[model samples]
Target: MGDGLRLALTTYSVNPRGGVVHTLELAEALQAAGVLVTVVALSDQGKGFFREVGVPVRLIDAPAPAPTLEERVFQSIATLTEYLGEIGDQFDIVHSQDCISARAAARIRDAGTSYRVIRTVHHVDDFTTQALMDCQRNAILEPDDVLVVSKLWQDLLLKDYGVHAGIVTNGIRAERFSAGISELRRKELRQKLGVDDRFVYLTVGGIEPRKGTAYLVEALARLKATHPNPPMLAIIGGHSFQDYRAYRESVLDSLEPSGLELGKDVVLLGTVSDAELPEWFSAADGFAFPSMKEGWGLVVLEAMAAGLPVVTSDIDVFHEFLTDEDDALMTNAGDAASLAQGLARLVDDEETRRRLAQHGPTVAARYPWSATAEQHLEVYRRALNAR
Candidate 1:
């Protein structure tokens, strides 16, 4: 993998979400490895984050006039053609992050261009009919090479959708997250959040049904009633879409009795910045994620890197990275009682939390961005060589 390879990655957005983080870290690692990489995003907000990280971002502008349905269709086609022409002479490969971007990249490659087309499928489970349709469409027009984040996703793509994809588990910057701040800093963060002297159980994700926020809240309520001193639950991240926003309000409404007031027992810190996440992770006694579905639970690795004990759903994707009673405590997904019990055991038992926190860093260290970048390099090379 020489520095001569020029690659362009296409994604929908560049927010600090899991997909955006994966794209940014991969691009940064590739650039560090001497590859000339350019990121192409649909939104300007996504481009801004990449630019801040020192990665070159080429954004496809929205339609000049207000876009009707027909105009939006035309705009997408026009942008794909324009981008293909603009970078055709400069890049060796073009990789798409999801179905929407893959559609455009596939069209460009079918136009007899020189650039090789690749696609990385981040999610496998199609919860809705529309989502299944999208996966089917992507399978129909699959690119030269397909990358999946986990073996479960790979199997799902092939067995269910007939799309052949290789596995490339997500990675994190272990060194950057390994910075162990003083216990005082952790204490101060908890104090600032009004959770001083209370066990903190942190859950980081958007307030969506698939994320199982309802289950987590129910588990918290259960813990409060069962335990003598229940841990304070800190739910970070914001609701981006309208459905989730409504669902979040409903969850909050249900939690009024458990002291849903802001900065109290149940705190919803909407969208914490990247800089502030480390302190919260360190301050928390345990990390709880009862998400029903996850393409790859990157937050689990992030929490482990920060040396926090994890209590997550017993999903296959999570099991690929963590083991029950070893790296994390696994609970039945969508089962509030199970989640609450799992969290209680970790919170009340200080020695158990300490064991998990101490051993988690060693497991997390194996998943650095450098290794992930090398795997992606091989995928790009294979895509370039494929007919």
Candidate 2:
């Protein structure tokens, strides 16, 4: 832990998206470990991060939203590159959490800055457009060192890109979520969300392609038919750099045919406050996350920390942390029928739910931000020595 070690951490946005959350948490943890960390992000219309940060922050003005994803990527890279160029020489390491930021870090490095560029590939995307594809490719290939959260992603990188990346899984603040909420506070949250007597299945990360929102809807529809009392599904936090209006429209259209109402049966509480997030987790009966892919499912760990029984996708990233019917009920990715069955089991089987809820905190306790920070320090030190 060098007191003189200064690092610049970059992310695409200041929103509560998984990557942004990772950047903020890591920056704070690193700062606590005696490293001078400055969190830099592309701000939309000059807005700051979702919550107050303990570490220093630099927000580059994005000013306005770009019409398309490709244009946004270009703008993010240009702005971050320009900003980093002005101050890049001051830091020993410039680490980026997303592709857009990674591209910018790569650009500044190409301009001959001595700062080491470290990129974390949370997950690979399947992009149809060549520009977006190339952006992803270059972001992965150009960085001095690439990191992934799980061995699943590390293996994927080696297989797909011929790149070997170090593995650093995510960590959680278990007690923040696991601490018992007062009954009054719990009632307040439930009342606020209009949840009364119904089992609430909560999923963060709003309607999007990767979140498997449509499939979750279909599962809810199926669960409604089989179960005596169908639980309400509450969705939270969908803010992202990419537009998902078309995907959102499709999810909305399916709601009518699935015999589900928008506000009552399925509540779309988009991007709730950071204070309210843990409260929502406390109020919900179960957590449902059927994402098709993730660098590592950070929310699943958060939900586990909150002592909520989880039903998530049987994806490789999840497999690294969860065991079927132990800490979480695993469902086949992209399969409505399988998800429905898994959800039904959680509803019907009290013993399994109790067991999962009991074990979840134990599982979540294994990952503390302190430990994650130590692992990252190792990576930073290695890169610095090599430099």
Candidate 3:
């Protein structure tokens, strides 16, 4: 329980999703802060993380695709538990970033592992599956200490689960997004993506219910009907453990009725290379992410850091970091018309876009990875003292 403490950070995926990114970045930041941190994750097909990191990492091969989400959940837990049991007592802290990893850590602890379990509840999901619901609940209750990314989720944990979770807000590698991409490279990327003259609106975090994918399509349709020069919506990053095919198909089926074409109006670039992500952010005119729920919108901060005027939902977590009509344009959650109006304003009004874009990087600068690592160090010490 010192500055150079040994810590093992666990997450469910090696994908470039939010939580996994948090684990990797936090590991690197913690390592820089003199902590011996290693990130262990359940990799698909033994794949490594999307990007390189400075810290040591372990990628455990996850069980192959299961027939049901519940089956997959249990399989992942068993897989991680078995792996952790082999080296569970090697670290002073075993910090899990998601439900599956948390459950795995809990199981190892239940079997008398000496390492303390720390869980970060990114956000609570409303799962209908009984198994997942129970798993999520156990992930919350079983950890010796629970941490949340935002005060909104911290309050919810206290109110709903009677757990007083510590707050460790998310941080961004601002330079990664804000770093200058040459004009020539930007033009080349735009041409490669067929984003010639169209005003491009970018959104990351794939097509899922929580991301409000269908509503975004509906908004695009509405925008196309009246606007003389319709803009393109570029969707990126849709990797998920749960099945979203039914949801994706539903969105695609509604496209024709909504007067929107697949490749032309809405482009779904599912999982681009990490290098291309920042280029996409730079090649776009604006960022639209009308998500329904988030532990914290990490991408919103990224978009802001990239200096794009962002359009996100009017939710509590966003309210924590963004102000309406200021740094970002906030619309009503799940309301297509409101989202369309927000999108329209971002397109039509130059001053508003400029103002928002100007303030974005300043706002993003507040949450540095170094500061986040320091806060985590405090939490890690407190957990050790309590034990």
Candidate 4:
């Protein structure tokens, strides 16, 4: 908040996942707050970040042929390790948005780079392999300061890692999503996607276990079996660091030859253009976020900004913001029938959808990027002053 309050943030990928999205938007907000900001990322994918903001982006080259998750993780650390090792002490704040960045920051310090890191543990995972577990643990232990998106995640860190992190919740670009709220654009997108008046449900997090794609597929099959002309579902976003090929095949293969036709009834819009994303959100009758795990459901706030009813998993983090039967309809994770019932309610009852949508924008309007920027500024000052 003063002179030379420079910030350098690192994220593992340039993919349009939640963490990367948070990094970009927060950078924009911090820049607007008169702070010098540089966004360092590991990919040049999606045309990079300059078009959206005026801040400089450091794109470290991570080439193709990433065959496995382990290889991908190592390559990310190696690339960032070199970059941060060389120039880690330049910024007043060196923050990481993902595991690999945390690892790199830790290694750079080990190599005698004098800098304290602020790591945002967006969410902690139940790592299956020892390698992944070490990645998460070492990242947490390395960071001098830690931040989490929700109180749920804060408690989780205390419970599991015996560590405490400050809470800084996510803020949506409500105006961006709301600006795309044109009835004309909505109908056009739906027609282009071949979705008719039949209730359309949209889920953006892609096909993965964390996103609860397997259970949602079962819900889709069940939803279609009961209704003659059932609703349509659009699955958006894909291809993150996780290798979900096996899980995708298992869940999707089970739904085939059933009433759920892949292209017609369900569309897998893998990685859509950013310009077209708001239009996609606008076209939805309801937003389905049935993830089994989350730090914060940032997209749910976005869907609310688009003025659509949301049907999300009734997880503790979700309860922090959303009120059941109010802002969003909640269902149990991994329960197909419960999810289907919520979906059916949104589709069959116009009043229910209208009611949820009515209250949604109000809840979404409370969290602004400016406020999030202020919170981050305070955290940055705390980290710097402590150093």
Best by lDDT: 3
Compose the digit string of candidate 1's lDDT tens values, residues 282-361: 77878998888888988888899988899999988888888898899999998998998898999888788988898889
RMSD of 4: 1.7
Query: Which residue pairs collide, candidate 4?
Result: none
| C-alpha RMSD of each candidate structure in angstroms | 3.1, 1.1, 1.1, 1.7
The C-alpha TM-scores of every prediction are 0.90, 0.98, 0.98, 0.96
Model 3 C-alpha lDDT per residue in residues 105-131, reported as the tens digit of each score? 989998998889999999887787887
Question: Model-by-model lDDT, in order?
Answer: 0.77, 0.90, 0.92, 0.85
lDDT (tens digit, per residue) of candidate 4 on 1-387 = 544687888998777888988999999889888888999888754346523656788888775647777777887788889998777777777889988998898788778766778899998766677898888898987888989999998998999888889998789878988875567777888886697677889999888889998878788788899987778889998857777889888877876866677887788899888888888888888899999999898999999998999999999999999999989999998898999998888888889989998998899998898899899998888787897
Over 78-130, each residue of candidate 2 has an lDDT whose tens digit, in order, gives: 88889989989988999999888898888888889989999999887777799
Q: Candidate 3 — worst ten consecutive residues by lDDT sum?
A: 189-198
Candidate numbers sorted by lDDT from highest down: 3, 2, 4, 1
Span of ten consecutive residues with least summed lDDT in model 4: 44-53
Off by over 4 Å in 1: 44-47, 62-85, 125-132, 239-243, 257-262
In angstroms, the error of model 1 at 143 is 1.8
The regions of model 3 sitting more than 4 angstroms off are: none
Worst 10 residues of 2 by lDDT: 63-72
1 against 3, candidate with superior TM-score = 3
